[model samples]
Target: MNQNTKIYGLVLAGGHSRRMGTDKGLLHYHNKPQREFLYEQLQNICDAVFMSIRPEQQAELPRGFRHIVDENMYRGPLNGLLSAHHSFPEAAWLVVACDLPLVNEKILKYLLERRNKKAMATAFATRKTGLPEPLAAIWEPQGLRQAEIYMKTAASSCPRKFLLNVETTLVHPEDDLWVANANEPEEQQRLLAKLNII
Candidate 1:
């Protein structure tokens, strides 16, 4: 069924960035903050978009896009996902991390094309790796409810554990470019070189 569902685009920007010693989302690549580029790309497909930010960093958020503060106070991306799911329970949520440099339009389109309403969620998977990249996934409204229930019982907000219980659909990572991310300085440099932006 072509649901034509209005999937909400959620950019996970609540990470502490302890490893990098800087906000990963605010770092620059190609003269634009990484998060802005991601939001720009995501806007192409999402019916509406919002950035998930930590409460303390709310002032640092870019203008124009709506912001959803993580009210649950968990230290993982699941908190942001749950917040969005709760806010828009009637629609699927396209959750993406802000630091991923390679999540281009092509891969996003491919993932969206494979979405099944019957499944709890859908995500990309490389044949070599299992369901490891939770950063790039689609969460149905029902999946969010399942996650919320699991989280309430588990008393923890781990996305992996939540995913274990849901009916998640998977897609082959035929497009390796979507896996590119800037986790550290070296990785950022590599992304710049790969994109020929530096």
Candidate 2:
């Protein structure tokens, strides 16, 4: 880790979870809330970490750590990214989604190693999945400003739309293990079963 490069960690936990039928971040996958697992893991790789959620759902969220609300009321993952950018304008944030239980310190360190100019974003790019996963990408403080402008002007609130406009470095997907995101209960069960935790 570069001492000069200060990076924060952001856990995107704002999803409505209509599909999961509950707060996805709070669901237990391995005897722990998914968000707590992510938060603990991110703590190993970042200077600071915070959960991004909606203001109305704040009460149902777990305590012990702080959270950032998307006051803009803007929809999509972009709202979480923008909120993190506004809260910590000085540090580059590694924006991760809570559903990605497979994310680890090694992957985060890999991204940090490739971080170059503020204009460049380091992301994972699989031949199967082009561009870094937006929710799993590294965002520089300056990049946050650019994303804000895009969100304000775009008719759609897609994070990918904002990322496409920026300069980025891509890491090809080497293993399927790195990109596993538990979107549904069955997927969550499979991940835990694969890990031999269930």
Candidate 3:
């Protein structure tokens, strides 16, 4: 890890959970809200932690937790990532989506330990599909800058696609469950069952 590039945590919670039919961030998975659980977990390792939310969500968050409202500058998770990047341009960000219930401290630590600063980003890739999981990856300052430029000419708003085309380091986690995302209602139920919460 480069001493100059500090790692800050950003929990992306601003998405419209239409498929889930409820706010995924507010879902109680580990006895607390899923987003808050991830936010607190990141506090243990990151220099600072923040939740990337929408403007309307600002009032919903409890005090003491730092938040950056999505500027809506870009699409998808990239909006939140860039908003945080714009706030602290020099620091690197360890980003996690709110829908991933299995993204615990161990998985986060694993990603951080394997971070390669020379690369644009150090992302977790699924062995099954060999696709990068941008939601649960570290975005270096340079990587974000490239992403910004990539967005300017690219029509696709997919973050994973950006990582796939860039000079990124792919890390395969020991457990694939660590990056499993609960996007729809069925997925939420299935993941909740896996967590023994259902």
Candidate 4:
């Protein structure tokens, strides 16, 4: 990574969680809100940490943590990712979604250790899917700039689609469990059971 560009941590907690039937960020799989757990994990590794949130979500947030409000310029995770990029254009954002209940501090440290600054972004990809997990990656400023361009196209708004065609470095974890997402209620329950939380 370039010395000029510091790595910052971003917790993606702006989703509506319509399918989960409640706020996913508030889920307590590890005795703390999932987003707070991620923020604290990132704080342990990155130069700084901030939570990406929707404008209305701010009031419900606990104090002391830094946050970047969504610009709402794009849909999906791109909105939070791009919003963080806009807030700190010079920093590389190590982003993690709030819906991921199994991701822990160790996995985040692993990602940082293997980051390729030369690549557009250094992302986690699973062997089973062979696809880049954009939300669980370090997005370089240049790559994020390209993502902004990619979003301009009417056909492509998804971050995974953008990363698939870009110069992102994919690092595979020992197992895919660390990157598992708990989007729907059932998925959350399954992950909770896996973690012995439920």
Candidate 5:
């Protein structure tokens, strides 16, 4: 953890989950909801942790947890990320998506250890595709500012694409599966099998 930088954890849970037919964040992955699991993991490393959720999903959120409701009508993870930035512009956010069941403390620790504060953002590079995993990333204040500027443009609002064009530090994950995201029932089943639950 960089002492000079105030790092906060933002759990992206605002997704519609149309493909999963349910809220992926509410799914049980490690004897608890995935969102709760991730929130606890973030609590260990961050000064404060907040879950990014849509307004309608507020009733479904677990009690005693701090959250930021998305104010933007834009679709996708960008809405959550930007909303978080808007709420706390001074803090660098270690954003994590709820669907990443394989994400553990070890992976987050590694990310923090190797974080390049000088860069706009520090993210992991997928071993298979060699592309930046934007969701599991530490977005510095400057990076978030740039993202806000990019959002105003006519270009695509894909975070990965923004990472590709920015000054970001990307590192390879210790284990490929550590960054695996289960978005659908089949993917969740596969992850469950990998965890020896099936």
Candidate 6:
């Protein structure tokens, strides 16, 4: 955690949750909405934190937390990341998805502590494939700029793919569970069982 670098947290909660059959961010896994939980956690480590949401979801956002609504028509997490980058192009974004129920302070601390300032981005490598996990990563200003340019072409929508072709510092997560995200009911149930919620 460089004291001079302004790192802002971006909680991605704009997804339509088509696979989950409900808003995954609004789901309760830790006695509070997962979005809220992640927001609180980010608040502790970031200079400031904002929720990435759609304009329609603004009304449902909890009060007192800052947010940036999608301005472009693009779908998926790229929209949230780029929206936040456009809003605050100077600060590096510590991006996290709302569906990651197992994300914790320790994991966040580890990521920040090991952030490679010189790399285009600092991300965790998936335990399964060793590919960069863009959502659980830090996107520097330069990286975001590159991403903006990439977005102009049809080849750069998928974040993981973008990471794969970029200069990213990939670290193995201390615990793979920290990066696990639940996108379906069955996955959510499995996570719930792991958390002893069932």
Candidate 4's displacement at residue 188, Å, is 0.7
lDDT of each: 0.78, 0.76, 0.92, 0.91, 0.89, 0.88
Candidate 3 lDDT over 1-198, as tens digits, reads 456888999999999998889999999889999999999999999999999999999998999999999999898889999999999999999999999998899899999999999999999998887889999999999999999999888999899889989998999989788889898988888888888877
Off by over 4 Å in 6: 1-3
Q: What TM-score does each of the candidates earn? A: 0.89, 0.87, 0.97, 0.97, 0.96, 0.95
lDDT of 3 at 43: 98
List per-candidate RMSD values in Å: 2.2, 2.6, 1.2, 1.1, 1.7, 1.8
Best by lDDT: 3
Looking at model 4, the pairs that clash are none
Tell me how candidate 2 scores on lDDT. Answer: 0.76
Give one digit per residue, the lDDT tens place, for model 4 in 160-186: 988889898998989998899898988
The window of 10 residues in a row where model 4 has the poorest summed lDDT is: 1-10
lDDT of 5 by residue, 1-198 (tens): 344889999899999898899999999889999999999999999999999999998997878999999987455688999899988888899999998988877789899888888888999887888888999999998898898888888368799998999999998897788888888999999998888867
Candidate 2 per-residue C-alpha lDDT over 177-198 given as tens digits, one digit per residue, 9 for 90 to 100:
6767788777878887766777
Q: Rank the candidates by lDDT, best first.
A: 3, 4, 5, 6, 1, 2
Clash count list over all predictions: 0, 0, 0, 0, 0, 0
- In angstroms, how far off is 79's CA in candidate 4? 0.6
| Candidate 6 structure lDDT | 0.88
